[model samples]
Target: MLRRNPIDFFNLIWSDEAVQKISKNTDLITRSKIEQNQENLKPHSRLRKWSSPSKADIRRLMGIVISMGVIRLPSITDYWSSNNVLCIPFFREVISRDKFWNLHVADPLPDNVSYPSKSYKIQWLLDHVNMRSQELYEMGQNIAVDETMVKFKGRIGFRQYNPKKPTKWGMKLFTLADSNTSYMWQQNLYVGADGRETELSKCAQHVLDLVEPLSNLSHTVYADRYFWTLGLAQRLIDSGFNINGTVMPNRKGFPQRLKSAKHMKPGEIIAFRKDDILMLQWKDNRVVTMITNNCRSDEWCTIKPKNPNHDTRNKPKCIADYNKHMNGVDVNDQLCTYYL
Candidate 1:
């Protein structure tokens, strides 16, 4: 091990200047939308602080929002209390609590502008963010795709319920991230419907939509059972990419023998292959099914069990790689929670 300057190896690949440009454009759009609606309302009925939002005003509002995360107060009023304002000089100088509360990113418009069921309110901002992410950095060969949940409890359409998540009730987003750094490269909001298309119609297209830009780059993708299928694996293989992930037992084209078999002992394995696609089931504590197009069937590896009751164990290459690289999105989630 060697001590070195952290700055020497730091790669500031992302451009803060580009993000500022996007934010400036968003401020103009939001201001125009709000003013358009202000004409129809009574003198004081329209948004007081947001009737005309300048770029500087928007920037100040954002600063307050970011500061709130670090302050970690239970309520918004607590942040603006006399005690807090006296102690926190930055917040005291920048903006008032009332202005921060009234901040709005998108415009509420007249009846003419059609609403998008999937992202009616913040679709423009979402699009800009995704575009900025792509421009900031190039992806590596190994990548992982997974669902991320953003907690929001307000009454809104398209709220997801995942019992396993720390925030069970919130928005759902599917993301593609770097396997090594956990940097999110692309993301799509899962709006159940956008007046024309339902979420069901897009579930099968999730993987292709997120990783489409990386096609022909020969990158290997790691995903869970949600997005992996025999047909998808075949499609990715044709596109010159490789994917490895777990497969659901009930997914179509899975061999009937594998599904019907019973009383399999620990470490026993069953496998199926068709052209570039390979499916396997290894009997661990429970039967684990995996699908891949690039892993060797005979490859083996060992993992030290975390449980004191268990010892070291041998696992297939597909399972070992999946465990190692499939945590990109999970790691990103953990990092975000620290500041949240």
Candidate 2:
């Protein structure tokens, strides 16, 4: 008697195990009233003659196909062209490339097998990715949230300008990155400009939701100025998160300096009152007046004179002129200090 190959015998045994597992784990077979269907089928009908593949056979074939595809298909086409004879039926039935590859070579099973939907598979993968990220972050990690844009040619629907790359047309893609490992935590696609209030809020919410699982372990969430808002700040503060960012300018009013009752002592620092006197000397002229917040004083110390005129009596001057000639003058030109 010809000795059967050990590999082939092992495959046969594995296929039997797979089929049994599927039947035992699922209600697809038990819930279906096959007896009624059998009764309905005509005696001569092809359907009445059909027999389901054994559970072991299904599992073995699935494993073989998956192993072969993964190891063999990297060079060219992902399909099993060499094993077309064995895989054609499975390729036609299995919607997932992974399932098709796995089931094609493991065992010779029927082609009518049904599997989960593509959407279901995609959601499962996404959930797995999120879970893995959470595990890593929980071990103490820093997360950074940043936005990007993805562009596609052709007018599929609404078109918008991308702020990051203004010339390109695409929707914003927000991503969370681990500061320590530089691993991407999660990414979200949005159909709007990055700077839009709606888009910014969505990005923030997405980051917050993704990191929610690892919130306790996350050290910090780094974001740009676009995410800096009073409401966003308050929300983070309420959540017991310390925010590190550039302080936004005060929009309400300028800070007030109180008047002191006593005269200024030498080397003593005093809040310069608005009524402090300053002699404004500009080219052959002198105007003495009280310094108000209207005239910025910071510029005087840093302002460079246009030209050192030996005849100090003849210089072209005005408060604005002196400020304009100075480099590094405060852009807002706010009065900085009182000159005695």
Candidate 3:
């Protein structure tokens, strides 16, 4: 499946079963809603009415939706505009603006009012894509797990507010992506409180589930402080996975001596070893702390400047490796926002 190039490989990723699922669900819900409206003595369409779409129609509809993302207009209604600047001729030829809304669906609506899950609306698509991702391609020896926010402002039970994110208010996802290729392998929706599990504890479980069969494979996993913890790193090391991530600035398990190491000169490095875990603190412009169980705490890499006039500087090898391997999710996030 990976051999196929460009979007020709997309069929293998999204799969036919999932596409058909959307087609069937769209027909079912649209029919039900129209029937309900009629029974209420209010007809749904005074204009072109909806007809049940087949899998092909659903696929085409999806193409239009994706194209809409790529070719941005000021408003949703602008795609069908006949104005020379605003009109996307192909969109009008394929389907009307009203028909597009009537046909769009990725998952089935609940048969009953009682919710099956917080993400039920797109749960099947999520499951299908995640399964296809892992099944289609194998991640490299090094992988990174991180959280990404899917922007959504509407009222919802699990909408998250992280002032740090570019899209500050939206649904949150725990994502595992390939460090080598930036391909997202697995993801779990953060559905807020499920039980007594705290965010720290949930991070441990998220890593376990995201990596799945990669356990005991000596795969290196990188995470940010939001998901990393000292004890969890030790546990993952015992489970046959290597851990490298930035340490959250907290008293949790960080050594106090290292905390004061911020006073060290720029580019000075220090490290501590606790059993299998190696805790390192390096001072650059400011003190940077990281915990690792994979590379040597004392290893250094000389970064030669491309311009010879600029002096080369030696940086901790561990810090360079962490920055290199931990950007899979961030890269994927950027592509989604900027490249549709």
Candidate 4:
């Protein structure tokens, strides 16, 4: 004996009156235009042998329509045994392949039946997603923006006329998210370009467009150093947005000359400077400069170095050594604090 398919068991339950009532609340009569069309279709008066379908027949036809409309498309075949089962119930109406083809499918409909045009569906889904993004933005959230790459399937060649380079695509994705709620706000996709500064700027501008609409909310943007140029920071600050991202290090700068620089030991304070700041380094190779807006010596005394060993080969050297060792360690924390 053959084992019965589990779907057949599901179909039996789906057709039961109790299941139908709990699953689908709408009446079968109002589910489709087929009944209305049937009523409007005129019959030939000369055909004396023709007769209207019986009440049972009408009920059977309604059951077919209801099965096609009420049952979800993925489960329709199991739910209803009907020849015409392609219709799906959506937004309170029955959408059938025939009706969709008539309204929006391309002309000269394929000999083989297919669903309606997909472009319209894509636009509809995008609009719905955008609307949801707006709703979340109004609720006061933080948005994180990032990008990624995607490879194309077809290939031409490198330095050769490859269709892949032209059509092979990468995308930059802008994601708006709520920091508190952890919900996604909005997302926009864009084509990737060469890693040139100009091309990157264009991608950043596109992301800004998606985020600008949420300026009224208490929104913050978090980005890496590459996305945090001086001009970009100034623009965000001028727009009344608070930024809490890593500062981009200055590429060009001068060395600071101190009178007691030679005598400074690891983890020792060399100078307080004009700014109320304290520079400390340790033998263990850790260096830090602490600065406070209040400009007090007590604030500097509060900071304790994590690593006490400053002179050890494994550790960072003193401030002067740090300046020589690190490429972007010139501007001490006090300098940044004072300037900001």
Candidate 5:
């Protein structure tokens, strides 16, 4: 994909099928908007003209969109300003600011849109990108499932707010990404209340949705405490996959001894096993409870802290592996933050 030409690279995500449909929808939306504006026009009002964008126009618009992330100013209008310091010549060369904003929509018509759906507006386009992504590359041996937010401060349903996230206010998503390259294999948008009968929490159910499709591939899927559970570990083990993740000490089925094990000093380790699943309580800054089907709780590896002041210590291999492979989504998020 890196070796592909610019046009070829664009086609991989925005295929001919997507481009054609979007072009028609863009024309329809622009026409409808212009008609509505004409109805309320005053003596000084000027109706915006409408023309269906060609395939080349669509490609150029997307290129400008990508470039906007790399180069930005205080206002959208600034990019097209006659003032030499604020103007970006490439933006005007491709399309005018008014035209770009007018053609920004590709949503389904009202009659065809599904009612009571949170993701319907952009789902069709997302489906195309996801299908193309899978076709383009194979994932790595290790996978990490986690959440990331897209920065959107708008009046839209299903917007999320997580104060802990770097992007605290935006679209919340559950993503399964390759640990090595941080390539997103699949993702599901977080819609409030899926309205399905289930024993798992909404977060756990999302992990199942993203990872279930990858079963029988012998992938080691890693997650954090908020998403993993003993039930999840058992399910993945049965499906020929492995799961290793930190767990909340107070979660159900946790050993009674581990709940109050805060007294345990740092580097102390205790574990309990039921068949193939091992539940470990390891003390670091805090006593962390973990459930796993593929890690060796008994094995230990040497650890050297990055800070020169901290002393070297022995750490569980499971913790070592988890630390190494669990940040794929975070790395992806960091890259996104830079662009945003």
Candidate 6:
């Protein structure tokens, strides 16, 4: 018998009860704001009465936001006023500016019976998205872990600023994605670095959390220098996973001997292996250090330079593979940028 597709077999994990709770909170906040404004109204001023939004209204508001990205309008009101989107019908009936502006997801509550103290304003939505993203698909053999910043410069405590990112000011999201298809299998918000966990351990934990479903499946994981470490490589190898990534010289457990500079020719590789883990430092124009769990550190490949005049360079097999697979998250980020 033919098996069902794993993606199709999974159902929406976001619960209706959760949606109801959020919608109720949104309505409560919106109505309370209107009431407060009415109380502060002048004696002869007319007060505008408004009703709370329902679940359907909230969905419509979200749809408008999605459409705004596609429309690329200057502002929300531009959809109606601008000549570009004028040809499109039913612009105003679906969502009004007032409804979109006043849209709320959660009410401010401090450690109540209904609201957990640790929970964030958008925690419910975040949890649902994470659950659904993971449930919908099974990860491929090759995967990667990286950070993606969502653009939000508003006042939020968890907001992070990374000068290197295209979106320098936003919330940080750590994602695990398939290298082959750039499919996001799992993701989590980077809610400030925890003091309890070391930077190396935090990176490893994020990787493990993303690949938890594929733990014993003999998969190969690729990451950049930020998350790769000798201890993580050993731990992953012990858990029946192969890992390969670039490493910095200063990382804990990195061999001091390998750090020494030796005048060497291109393709010259110095490898150190302890059990299943392998660390290799290959010389090109400069030394490129890498660590792997399952790759043969001795293996080398011919690499042609981008400039045709430059001579071809020799790169380690692990480095070549890392170069190819490490762009999964980057490619996803580009796609998102293009869409935006």
lDDT tens digits, residues 48-70, model 5? 44567887788777788778889
Assess every candidate by TM-score: 0.83, 0.34, 0.91, 0.35, 0.93, 0.82
Tens-digit lDDT string for candidate 6 (1-340): 9887643432254345655666788777766565677767666432243466677776676567657777775566677563654534455778765566667766556334463323367776777777787777788889888999989877877888899888999888888888999987777887765566554578777777777778788889898888877778877877789998888867787778777747767757788887878888888778888888767966778989899999997778999999989888888888887646
lDDT of 2 by residue, 27-109 (tens): 23322433447667567654343344456545544554555544444432344344654444443343334332222222222
Each prediction's number of clashing residue pairs: 0, 20, 0, 11, 0, 0
User: For residues 148-262, could you state the per-residue lDDT of candidate 1 as single tens digits?
Assistant: 9998888877889999888688889999999999998888999874344533335557788888888899999999988777777877788888889998867788898678657
Give model 5's TM-score versus the native structure: 0.93
Give residue 32's error in model 3 in angstroms.
1.2
Clashing pairs in 5: none
Model 2: CA > 4 A from native: 1-125, 136-141, 154-163, 166-171, 191-200, 216-218, 246-340
lDDT of 2: 0.40
Question: Order of candidates by TM-score, top first?
Answer: 5, 3, 1, 6, 4, 2
Query: Which predicted model would earn the best TM-score?
Result: 5
Between the candidate structures 2 and 6, which one is better when assessed by lDDT? Answer: 6
Worst 10 residues of 4 by lDDT: 325-334
Single out the weakest 10-residue window by summed lDDT for candidate 6: 6-15
Once fitted onto the true fold, the runs of candidate 4 whose alpha carbons sit more than 4 angstroms away are 1-124, 148-171, 192-200, 247-340
Root-mean-square deviation of each candidate, in angstroms? 4.6, 20.7, 2.5, 18.5, 2.3, 4.5
Better of 2 and 4 by lDDT: 2
Candidate 6's C-alpha runs over 4 A off are 1-22, 35-38, 41-48, 80-90, 107-119, 195-200, 262-264, 302-313
The runs of at least 3 residues in candidate 5 whose Cα sits more than 4 Å from the true structure, single-residue gaps closed, are 1-7, 42-47, 111-116, 307-311
